[model samples]
Target chain A: MNLLRTAREMLEGTSYTLGIAGRTALALPQLWRRRRETTEQCYAASVKLIHVIVLVGAFAGMILSLQTGLALADFGQEGSIGSIVAAAMVREMGPFITAVILAAAVGSALAAELGTMKVSDEITALEVMSIDPVPFLVLPRVVALTIACPLLAIVANVVGIYGGSIVAESLLRVDPLAYRETVYDVLARPAELFPFPKDIYAGLFKATVYGFLIAVIGCSHGLRASNGALGVGEAARTAVRNSIILVLVMNFILTRVMYT
Target chain B: MSTAASDAGAAVRFESVEKQLGGKQILRGLSFEVPRGTSFVIMGPSGSGKSVTLKHIVGILAPDAGRVLVFGREPGQLSRSELASLRSRIGLLFQDGALINWMNLEDNVALPLREVQRLPEREVRPRVAEALERVHLADAAQKMPSEISGGMRKRAALARAIVSRPELLLYDEPDAGLDPATGGSINRLIRRVQRELGATGVIVTHSRSCALTVGDRIGIFEQGRMASEGTAEEMATSSDPRVRIYLGIDGEATTERSDSRGAEHGTGATGR
Candidate 1:
């Protein structure tokens, strides 16, 4: 009986998430009509998240480069650490870490904010005033996330690559110029399977998808929130948890699809 | 009976409306009407579905059966765009004020005018200022909702509700959770705003004082049904034991207890 109930809840949650995504898609035109609102949301989501993205990206890059360099040293291939770090960050880790940061920061904030509004009847008030909550609230957030995620991913890419280079030069005794040259060469090379370099388009695709998913999931939890303050807190926690899990799961899937 | 009178220029009418929420029947064949350009107050005990009834008028909660007519049109039958257009003509002041906490008082009041009505900033500014002034929150215009007193927040919400000068206004527990003086002032504000806009007004409240002060007509809800409805004088003079018990007019405490239970169980009408 417990298992059945859990299964039912999961199904309901998935449908609810899909419903929000569909509504957000339909409300996309409001991004133009309410450009100022969308712009403000975009600025808010991006500005607060940039620092986290850079800090996390740099550390992740350094750790990956140092560990991989040490492992490859046994094989006398430590000089190729730049190629591995650049490829991993660009194709996977950059977007994944950026998404995780955004999920914790922006996605949780969105859920808490909207959940408070829901419990307080502000969303109902909007509807009473003839403002569809989807167009007025969710559309701007979704559009902003979609726009901000890719830009943050780019920032992550730059920071991560630079961090990897610094670690390679300092720890692996690899030449800075040689590491830079190898990273550029590896990222610019065409894939044997795909038309474009695996890193560029694939990383961006993941970032955009992660951004869209975060917004939709956060908004869904928020809109369904009830009970009041405790409920709002729960919604925020759930949004962040779900966002992190989904981002990691999608990262693995996307990497496999793009690379293998 | 209310539905019959509804056609005589009623702004809102509910004919045998039923609603169930969270496995409980909240509005059980409920019926009421608010005549155009008049104030109708529905007073009830806690959990008696006053707010749910208010939601039905705006199409926020559709009736499970029967009809809810707003501006002589069935809200459930309208398309989304059509419903939005319909709602633009109505204003709602929710319980707890429902002001956007992130926005300052002035912007909160200006939102409906700018977003819903699509009014330009030049036009929105003056209207927002005037509404704030009327609510006597002009000094707190730049203050966020959390920065203000509860009474001030309620006033700010009132300002937002009236800023658009809607054709209809709905207030859900407008006087709830306030001291008598603050609740009295909010009630007076509701009356004044309704009169100024000539908007049909429907207020949900538990305060008999609020109902008597603001209602051109009053309905008493009990157990998901409107038990009695009349003008202030008529309701005050009502011989119905449930009405007397609710109004605190019955001197006998034992009778009050029995009547209260009956009202809760929806058996009071038969007992009377």
Candidate 2:
């Protein structure tokens, strides 16, 4: 009986998520209609995270480069650290790390905001005023996140590659000239393994999909919130947890589809 | 002292409506009507489906059984655009003000004008100022709702409700959690707005003072059903035990009171 109940809940949750996606798609035109609102939301979503993104990206790149360089040293392949770090950052860590940060910060904020509105009757007020809350509230947040994530991921990629270079020069003692040459060779060579630019494109695609999914999860949990303050808190907690798990899962699937 | 039916002149009418929420029956065979250009008050204890009934009129919730007609059109039967059009003609003041916390008082009141009416900023500004002035919150227009007092918040909500000059107004406990003086003033403002706009008004309250003050006709709800309905005078002198108990009137004492005195003083101090 418990298993059946759990299965029913999972089905309901999936159906609800799909329904929100369809509604969000239909409400896309609202982004154009409410351009100022969309822009403001985009600014709010992205502006405060610049410092955090830079720090996380740089640290991730340094740590990955150091670990990979140490492992390769035993095999006398330490000089190849730049190529490996750049490829991994471009293909996976950059987008994944950025997504995790945004899921915790912006996604949870969206859920809390909409949940409070639900509890306060503000969403009902919009309905009473004949303004659909999906178009008025959800559309702007989704569009803003979609536009912000790719841009943030680009920043993460640059910082991560720079950090990797620094670590390679300082800790690995790989010749700076040799590291630069390998990075350029990896990115510039069209026939290299994993190829030039494909991994970068894959990273950007993952970022965009992650952004869209995070917004959907946050908004859906918010709109479904009931009970009041406790309900709002639960919605925010659920949004963050679900978004992180989905991002990791999606990262794997996207990697398989892109590389294989 | 009977269930009012929908008439050609009625602004809102509920016919044998029933609603269930969370596996609990909230409204059971409920029925009432508010005539155009008059105030109809539904007085009931808490959890008696008063708010649910108001939601049905706005199409926020649909009835599980029976019909809700607003402006002679069945709300549940309307298309999306039709419902939007119908809702634009109505204004609702929620119990807790329900102001958007992100926006300050002026912007909150101006939202309907800018969004629903699609008015320009220049026009919306003056209209917002006018609404604030009417509610005596003009000086506090720039302040957030949290910065204001409870009475001010309620007044701000009232300002938003009347800003668009809606033809129908629904107020959910306009005087809830208010002191008697403040509640009285809010009731008076509601009456004044209704008269000035010549709009149909429906108010749900548990306060007999509020019902008698604003209601041209009054309906009492008990246990998700309309127990009885009548004018202020008729309700005060009603012989129904439920009505007597709900009104807090002793049957013998009410009988000894002159009909004129009951009618004159039935609404308490706010009536004048």
Candidate 3:
């Protein structure tokens, strides 16, 4: 009986979350009128997220360079570390690292804030005032994150590649100029469809999808919160957990679809 | 209210409205009518579905069975824009004030005017100031909700509710979590707003003091159903045990005194 009830609730929650996403898509037409709130949210979601992305991006690149460069050292080919780091950072690690930071920071914060508002009747207050919470509250958040995540991923890619270049020259005894040329080579290579390389486009596309999912999940869970503080805690926790899981799963699927 | 307004129709009507939450039936065939421009209070114990019924009128929740009509339009059946149009004519004061914590009192009160009416700042400023003045919170307009006391928050929420000059006002436990003195002030504010605006009021409270102080007519609810409803004088004489127990009507003398006291305040079951 408990399992059945749990399954039912899970299905209901998934459908509700999807409905929120669909509503967000439909609300795009109202974006111009609500530009001020969306701009404010953009500041909160993106400007506040830059430091975390930079720190994580740098460390992730340094680790990638050290591990892969040494492994190639056994075959006297550690010189290839530059291309490997650039490709990995652009295709997978850049979007992934940005998503991890965002899921933990912005996503959980959205859930907790909205959950508190739900418990306190603030959302209902908005509704009672004839303001739809979706267009009023959720749209700005979803749009802000969707726009910010991809741009922030570019920040992550640049910083990570530079961090990898430093590790390659200092730790692996590679020349700085040679490392730069190889890194530039990978970035310069073009894909089949677009003028840009597949790595850059794929990473950004992935970030956009991940960002949308995080905001949608966070807002959905928060809006459904009941039972007060405990329920709010659960919403925030679940939003982060679900966001991270979806990011990893989507990373693999997008890689296979775009690359293979 | 004019006789024509009364003859036109009730401001709100609940027809055999039933609702369930999490496997529990919160409202069971609840039925009532709130006359246009009268303060109608539904007094009941906790979990008696007073708040749930208020949400229905707001179109926040639809009844699983039956209907809720606001000014002759069924709220549950209205489309999103239509419901919002209906809701724009009403204002609700929640138990906890429900002020958007991030905004100052001025912006909070100014929200409906700016967001729904899209009024220009030149017009919104004075209207917001007037509402704060009406609630006697004009001095604290710049203060955040967290900076205010509980009573002040309720009053600030009242300012926000009335800034739009809504036609119907709903109060969900307007006196909860306050000392009697503060509660009395809130009760007075509700009566003042209802009378001054010529707006219909549907207040849900378990506080007998509130019911006696603000309600022109009162309904006593039990287990999601109406046990009794009448004016203060009629309720004072009601032999219904549920009404008797809930109102704490001890004897004929006490009931007479309570009714007269209620009348003196110009509201308490005066049947106005």
The best candidate by lDDT is: 3
TM-score-superior candidate, 1 or 2 = 2
DockQ of each: 0.76, 0.77, 0.74
DockQ for candidate 1, please give it.
Answer: 0.76
TM-score, one value per model: 0.89, 0.91, 0.91
Q: Ten consecutive residues with minimal summed lDDT in candidate 2 chain B?
A: B256-265
List chain B TM-scores, each candidate.
0.86, 0.86, 0.89
TM-score value, chain A, candidate 2: 0.94
lDDT of 1 by residue, B1-272 (tens): 23345446679988998999989999899988888999888887878888888878888789889898987788788888878877877888888889988789999999898888789889999999999887777777999998876777888998998898888988888878887667766776677777777889998877776776677787889989999998766776689887776665533322322222112113211111
How would the candidate models be sorted by DockQ, starting from the highest? 2, 1, 3
For model 3, what is the alpha-carbon lDDT of residue A221?
Answer: 91
Q: Give the 10-residue window scoring lowest on summed lDDT in candidate 1 chain A.
A: A190-199
What are the runs in model 1 whose C-alpha is more than 4 Å off? Answer: A191-197, B1-8, B249-272
Judged by whole-model lDDT over C-alpha atoms, candidate 1 comes out at 0.83
Lowest-lDDT window of 10 residues in candidate 2 chain A? A187-196
Q: Model 3 interface RMSD, in angstroms?
A: 0.7
Model 2: per-residue lDDT, tens digit, B131-150?
88766778889999988877
Q: How many angstroms is residue B148 displaced in model 1 relative to the true structure, after the best TM-score fit?
A: 1.5
